[model samples]
Target chain A: MIEIQNLTKKYGQIVAVDNLNFTVERGEILGFLGPNGAGKSTTMNMITGYLPSTEGTVKVSGYDIAQEPNEVKKRIGYLPENPPLYTDLTVDEYLSFVSELKKVERSKREQQISDIMELLKITDVRKRLIRNLSKGYKQRVGFAQALIGNPEVLILDEPTVGLDPNQILEVRNVIKDLRKEHTIVFSTHIMQEVSAVCERIVIINKGKIVAVDTPENLSKAITKNSRFTIKIAGVKASVIGALKAIDGVKNVEVSDKVEEDVYEYIVDSDKQVDVRKPIFFAMAKLGFPILETKEEELGLEEIFRELTTKNIVVSTESDNSKQDASGEAPEEDDQAEEKEVE
Target chain B: MLSVYKKELRTYFYSPLAYVLSGIFVLVFGIYFLTQTMSKAGQGIAQIVFGGQLFFASFWLVMLIPILTMRVFAEERKNGTEVLLMTSPISVPQIVIGKFLAAFTVFLTMTALTAIFPIIISISGDLVISNTLSSYLGFVLLGASFVAFGLFTSSITESQIIAAVLGTVTLFFILLIDQLKTLVSGIFLKIINQLSLYEHYKQFVQSVISLKDIVFFVSLTGMFLVLVMIVIEKRRWSQG
Candidate 1:
């Protein structure tokens, strides 16, 4: 339902969105995953006809945004990062104004607004001033505004950013339900938000597309090494030696000491190896009881960090190496990752 | 365009700024009316002299029109609501025209309330119908031009205060261009005198309904409104 081709936005010397190419099928929820300053909002603005791309095109329902903006805008409903609300207007008044601005039919305006208000669960606060409402309510009202014209495509820029956890869950559920009828392109820095609702995730960083695939495929493609964490009641040296002696074990590092004679070891092995059963038998043969065992599969959070941080590390490797003389580049990388995630 | 016009009008009524500004406009006009009448009472002239009253009221436009128009586009940009308007199906010209008309409506309403002075004068003495009507026509045209200028200033900035100040200062200069005639001579002095808004407005006050003055106000208003539309359209491409 939507196609973006080489969509680039430049602010003088800085390129905010660079040759971004993507598509959204009808009734599909495409997740836009990126950290701060990742040009997600810039991309969304171009798609909604609010901003003109310096060089490229965005088409909605086969109409070019630059050539026929009104036709494209007619099919897309956008909720910007700030929600674009008039605080002095009541909920009903704001929605009514949006409906009119969208050129909804006069006869169906009231019913459509009520239905949207009901879907967003903002019916009770319909008469109250939007300024007096809570943040969550304001967000829902913003969402309700996007649903007013029943547009085919909805471009929401961080719909759940300022909401509470429950409100976030509620919004996710709403997005999930919206997939039955509307094609959704939502941007967020939250990993779980995309994993929970989007059919395909597009991870972008520094104005470029890093990875695009389903959540499962993205995780599976990046994690090529099988890792296991095991806790055994034996001397730490013996536990490490026995684990390394296994046929497919690549490396064994004692990560922590859980208790006396009980050490946790992180076991790395070849991707094709099933080392869990072998490690169990090896520990049993050594008279070392296995206290606990866990197969450490990479979660979406790690995959996101790995995808987004790899580029940063490559671009600034020289600067990073000079900054950290102790060869703790990995630790510094982790700190940089944390800052980006926050 | 109609939708935006209605929404803007509704917003004006909802906010207290419109009420306060309109109240001040009426109060000031009433005071001027009473003073003009009291001072001319000894000449047996019970005629409602609105030409002088409107000339004074034009000064109030320097203050009140900016206050009325400062928030038209500046507030939208500040609140991030410009995104909503730009992304809608409406055209930039439509939004500009809609807002221009909404502000014009409020100015008309404020000026309409001053008609009571003429009604009171007509009850006691002869009413100069042509002069009163021409003066009002000139005032409306002049006010529309100021509204357009103020709207243009509002479109250029996100801060309402800056919009108001810019609108007030530029408009003050435009209205008082004749005063600057003293600083120049020859071609420059003629240019300054010709650019004076008060010069064009004085013809209407004297009941001279020349097409030249009418065209000047209409074209000036159109030019400013077009500038507002261009500024809004250009921002879409230039904004980061």
Candidate 2:
């Protein structure tokens, strides 16, 4: 439903988004995963017609963003990192105003609002002023505003930020329910959110698209080297010597010495080798016993770090992190939440 | 536009900024009306209404322009609601127009309170109905133009104080250009004088509703509203 090409947003010397190209298919929930200052929100802003790209074209539902912003706007419900809300207006009044602004049919505006308030579990706070409502409720109200016209595409920027665990799950489930009808793209730093709601994942770093694939594939691709963490009750010197003798083990490094009797080590295995079994067998042969051993399967987080930490992908010549200043942006970007209001 | 109008009207009451502003307006509008009507040196009721719109009524717009305009795009940028509207199906023009009308509605309420001035005046002297109506119409158009200017200033900055200051400066210059206009003679001075808001405001005092004056007010409103639209467009491009 959305196609962004050569999209670059520059603030004078600093480029926020650089020569980015990606397409989000209709009915797919695309998770935009990036570290802080990865241009995820900038890309989202350009896509939703909130901010204009310095260069590049964004087409929403086949309409060019620059040429037909209103039509594109009609199709999108955008919740920025901070929910744009009028604190003074009651939740009912705020949603009603949004409904009218979105040009929802006069007769159905109330019904649509009621349904959304119910779906987002905000029925109780409907009558209260938005200022008095809690952050989560304000977010839901922001979501209600986005849903006012029932747009075909929903572009949410950090939708689940600042919520309690329960509220996060509630918001996630609501988004899952929304996927049946609308094309959804949400940007977030949360790893579980991407795995939970998105069918496709786009990992961005330094204002560029680093990799785009299914979450499973991205996780699997970055974790080819299997490392096992084994804690053995023995002298560190003997355990190190015994570990070096194992055939499947390519290299072993002492990760930490957890206790006086226990030595914690990370053992690397070359290509699909079942080194855990060998390590247990080897430790058994020696007087030292295997206290605890587990194959440390890397989570999505490691995969994300591998992709965003700089210069991980070697084969492709897509101009991504080359132009960026690298790592200097994270501190400034910690205020991503605050910058939304600026 | 209706949504904007309603929200803006509610903002005045909710923030009590409107009540405070209306209180100021009534004080000035009432004092002026009383001095003219109670003079009974036999100043016409039409004269008071006409004269009130000419000089004093617009002061309400002047002071109000800052408060009403301060929060337009600037506060949205502050609170982050500009994204909500910009990302919606609303066009730049619509955003500008909606906000302008909303502030204008607040201005309208302030002016409406001053309606009591004319009513109180009619109790003392002859009230020519057509002239009183023309004066009110002139006030509406002029108030609208100032609101448009205020909206334009708001769109240029995220700081409300900056927006308010820019609005005051822009309005003050427009109101006081007659002396400055003389530096550049003849046609230039005439054009500059005509461009002055207070200059056009004088036409309402004599009961003249010339098409030229109407065109000037309408063009002023349109031009400022268009400028606001352009400012918002450029801002999004720069920051989005």
Best-performing candidate as measured by DockQ:
1
Q: Provide the lDDT at A282 for model 2.
A: 76
User: TM-score of every model?
Assistant: 0.91, 0.86
In Å, residue B128's CA in model 2 sits off its true spot by 3.5
- In model 2 chain A, which range of ten residues has the least summed lDDT? A314-323
**Model 2, docking class:** medium
Write model 2 residue lDDT over B131-217, tens digit each, in one string.
778888888888888888888888888899999988887787766685686589888888887777777877875688889888899
For this target, which candidate reaches the highest TM-score against the unseen true structure?
Answer: 1
Q: Tell me candidate 2's interface RMSD.
A: 1.9
Question: Cα deviation in Å at residue B226, candidate 2?
Answer: 0.7
**Candidate 1 C-alpha lDDT tens digits along A1-342:** 888888888776666776777778899999999877777888899999988999989999999999999999999999988898999999999999999999999999999999999888899999999999999999999889888799999999999978999889988999999999999999999988889999988877766676777888777777878888888999888888889899899999889988899988898898888888888898899999998888876888998899777753221222112221232212122222322221
List all candidate RMSDs to the true structure: 5.5, 4.4
**Model 1 regions lying over 4 Å from their true place:** A230-239, A253-265, A272-294, A312-342, B181-190
Q: Report the lDDT of model 2 for residue A205.
A: 76
